[model samples]
Each structure stands twice: as C-alpha cells, then as structure tokens.
Target: MQGLAQVPRLLLSYAGVQFEDYHYENPDHWFKEDKLHLGLDFPNLPYLVDGEYNITESGAIQRYIIDRWGPAELLGKDAKEKAKLESFLSIFTEIAGAAKGLFFNKEWETAKTAVIEKYRPKLEQLDKFVGENKFVLGYLTLADFVVAEDSHYIERLFPEDFKAFSFLGRIRAEFNDLPQIKKYYEQPKAFKGRFFPEYAAVTIEQ
Candidate 1:
C-alpha cells in the first residue's frame, strides 16, 4: 500500500510535519468512498487533506509540504537552484517511467535490459553531479528525496546495475541516516517493501 504514496509521507516525516497516514489494504475506501467525499480538484491516490487545502498530484503535494513545513532550503535557495532541481526531477521521472514496464507489466524477463540501458546515461549524469556532495544542490532538498526514493527501487530490483551508480547508494544511505528519517524508520509502524502493491508483476523487499 505504500508504493508511490509513500514518497510524500517520507517528505512529511523528514520535515517534522505531523499528519495522519491511512493505508488502504483494499482500494474500495479510496475509489468508492474517499474519492467521492474528499474535495480534491483532481482526485488521486496520494491526495493531501489539510484543514482547507486539498491537493493532489505527488509533485505539487511535495512542494506544498516542503514550502509550508520543511526548511526553506528544501525547495531551493534561489531560482537557478530550483531550476536545477527540476531538471534532476525530470531525469527521475523518466527513469521511474521506464521501470513501469518491468514492474507492472510483468516484462522483467524481456524488458530488464532495456530498462537498465535506459537508465545508464541518466544515472551516470547523476553520479557525476553528485560527486562527493552530501546531497543534491550540495544540501538537502526535494531532489535528494525524489532521487533517493527512486534509487531505493533501483537498488532493490537491479542490484548489479545499481552498484555501477556509486553516488546513488551514497545518497540513499545518507538520506536514511538523517535524524528524522532514521527516527521514522525506528517507529514500530514503519513498513518497507517494493514501491508497489502486492499484486504487481514483480516485487522486491526493500
């Protein structure tokens, strides 16, 4: 149930934003109930319900949460930095999009090579960009979270390919080691699995 929805929750936790997290073991509650009741303009899986702000779309929700609750630097220090972060985000989106064939379509046997090949150049760029830096943009920002989350999937699903991207593992490890993230994982309720539902064509425990 975590899946894509888990990303914002991780950002919320890291930002020290206290919010209720509901994991629907069944989809009925969302599709039949909440989707109809929640006043979101665009109803989606990871919608956020603040007292008056109802937002959907993972990228927008991440921006809202970080802008409202996280440190100012999380978004970026200036316009140029924000632009760079968005560029990294674009790469992440493409990499994740390519993974859909392997995970949801049950195409791993035939699609694995294509997926890994698709990631090679993008990952190399990221490794070079992140060379020895503690975080993207040289400090914690939304890009780090997005990249780390995607990297977690890659590392778990394609260990060999992931190993070649040295900085990715470092970023994920450093992110997980952050005080807030470490505390979140230490909580009894924290759960980890493939970033997809159990019914997915492929699953990897992360």
Candidate 2:
C-alpha cells in the first residue's frame, strides 16, 4: 500500500511525471537487506530513489517534488498564500493525529462516541474553512490533497458522521474529478495489510 507515499505519488501523477511504483511485501526483510546500500542517512519505507537524490520523510519528499516538478500553484503563489496553505496542512495533520486511534484501535466501537466528541469540533472547523472553495487555498494545492487523504479513511469508516460535513464531501468529489486523480483512483495500489489489515473487513456505505 502507498501510505505516506501516496502524497508524492499523487503529486507526481498530477504533474504527469512517469515514475516507478515499488511495493514491499516484506518490508522488514527488505529493510535489513537493502538499508545500508540504499545510501540514505536514515533509510525508511516509501523513500524515493530519484537518481542520486534519495529523499526520506513524506513531507520533505512531497515538497521536493513540488519544488522541482510542479504546476507551482500547488505550493501557492506567494509567501502569504504559502503560509495559509501550510497552516491548513498543519491543522489537517493535527486532526489526523487526533483521529488515528479510531482507525487503528481494535476496540473502536467502545470508544467511538468519545472519539467523535473529541474530533467533531475540528471537523466542523474544517467544514467551515472549506466552504465552497475549489481547493483548500482557493486553488489546487498540497493542502487539499493532504486533508483529503487524511479524511478518506474516516469518511469510509463513518459515512453518516462525515455526511454531516457537506463541504468535505464536495471537496472529495471535486478532487476525484481531476483527470489524473481519477486515473490514479481507477487502479489504486492495494492497501498494505501490514498497516491497514482491517480495512478490507470494513464495508463502505454507498
């Protein structure tokens, strides 16, 4: 499964850059076998080996791609715009952090109410921030993709809860409509069972 890699993958796809997609079925074994040879200071899964430049860390890798091969708009048009986008990204990360337990916990049902209560305020804040915008920063940007990706599992896990946040649904629809994104979604990489083993067992409501 792509996991953090999906952000860079989507950005690359959006830029129409042809790149290799590698999946490791046994990451632990692979790490032990190739870590030293990979030439990374701190080798990690989902690292990009672009010629001599090996980049680790999802956020840095995504920014590197955007800086080198981007539509520019994705990074924002100016300092102020970039700051706004980054701020949104920060908050999106916060929301994802707050909600991680709900997705990964074996006893999610037992604490579902408490989890919703804690995160609903942030979700509503996001809903208000996103009202009728074409993208998170009024145009396509990394912020939009980050937020969408983070929210996707929750949207699937709790459709009724997410449906109450109409703006999020609209953003998802708009983002999916992009030609490149649509193509990517058509044949998404299988979710890595190691990270999301229960994902398959969870049914998505239509």
Clash counts per candidate, in order, are: 0, 0
Candidate 2 C-alpha error for residue 103, in Å: 2.7
Per-residue lDDT of candidate 1, residues 44-131 (tens digit): 8788889997899988988988888878788889999988888888887788767755777766768778788878888889778878
State which candidate has the highest TM-score. Answer: 1
Instruction: lDDT for model 2, please.
Output: 0.74
Clashing pairs in 2: none
The true-structure Cα RMSD of candidate 1 reads 1.6
**Model 1: per-residue Cα lDDT at residue 21:** 85
What's the TM-score of every candidate structure? 0.92, 0.85
